[model samples]
Target: MQPDPRTNLNNELAQLLNNRIVEPDYKREITITFRVSSAEKTRLEQRCSGVVQSDYIRARLFDYPLPHPKLVIPEVNRQAIYELKKIGNNLNQQTRAINEAVKIGSQPLSSNVKEYLQTIKELAVLLEQTHASLSQPISDEE
Candidate 1:
């Protein structure tokens, strides 16, 4: 007995129908809700004229530019800091020289040495003041 051709044809047609392609849509799957005053709604609709409401809202929501933070160092402060560092290095070298001279008994404590030490202390105070001033937030008045 021969197999039925109609049955085979029916099976082929069913297979082809089952294998047909289906394209997907591009719509999002989530929904959001918010309350707005009637005036605000009117303003938004006016701004969104000639564009779809959802597109305008989505662009405003997701494509807006955010303000970035900034670090500003004033030129005066930079120059002052550089000068302070140089002065600090000079003070350190002078202290080391005095210490070495005292250790070797080459120089004795004298009025000139005391005056130099007083000047170094004054310079240290000035450096601290400059650093504190630079670290403070800049005021609008300045």
Candidate 2:
């Protein structure tokens, strides 16, 4: 007796559908379509920053907290950054001068230079603390 061709085709189609349909409560295996204005899309992208668009959208849809983006250095921080760069350059020059003096068997580091280096170190510590404070999370109470 020959098997029914219709039954075989139905079975194959059923298997295909079963494979494609995801069980509920599983990681997303379905696609959702939506549209947004260009301005809204841009804002969303900017807010998400380093996050993938899909993940960001999902977080919003599900009311999950969005991940924080890296902090932008404020104008005050920018000035601090410039000062740090200047300090670093001066330190480099002082180190080079000291090295040259050592090569010539002469003392190159003056007391004033040592004091300046100590001041620079202290300034660096303060800058680091400021940066840390800036990056810290603010509580809603505050």
TM-score list, all predictions? 0.45, 0.41
Off by over 4 Å in 1: 1-71, 140-142
Clashing pairs in 2: none
Q: Write the per-residue lDDT of candidate 1 for residues 1-142, one digit (tens) a residue.
A: 9989999999999997776443433677988989999999999878865466666776565553322223355888878878888988898789888878977889887889878878888988888888777866555577
Model 1 residue pairs with clashes: none
lDDT of 2 by residue, 1-142 (tens): 9999999999999998666642335566789888999999989888787677876776666555566555455677667767766776776677677668757879757787677667766766776676576655444376
* Span of ten consecutive residues with least summed lDDT in model 2: 17-26
lDDT of 2 at 42: 89
After aligning candidate 1 to the native by TM-score, how far in Å is the CA of 30 from where it should be? 30
What is the overall TM-score of model 1 with all chains considered together? 0.45
Q: What's the CA error at residue 120 for candidate 2, in Å?
A: 4.8
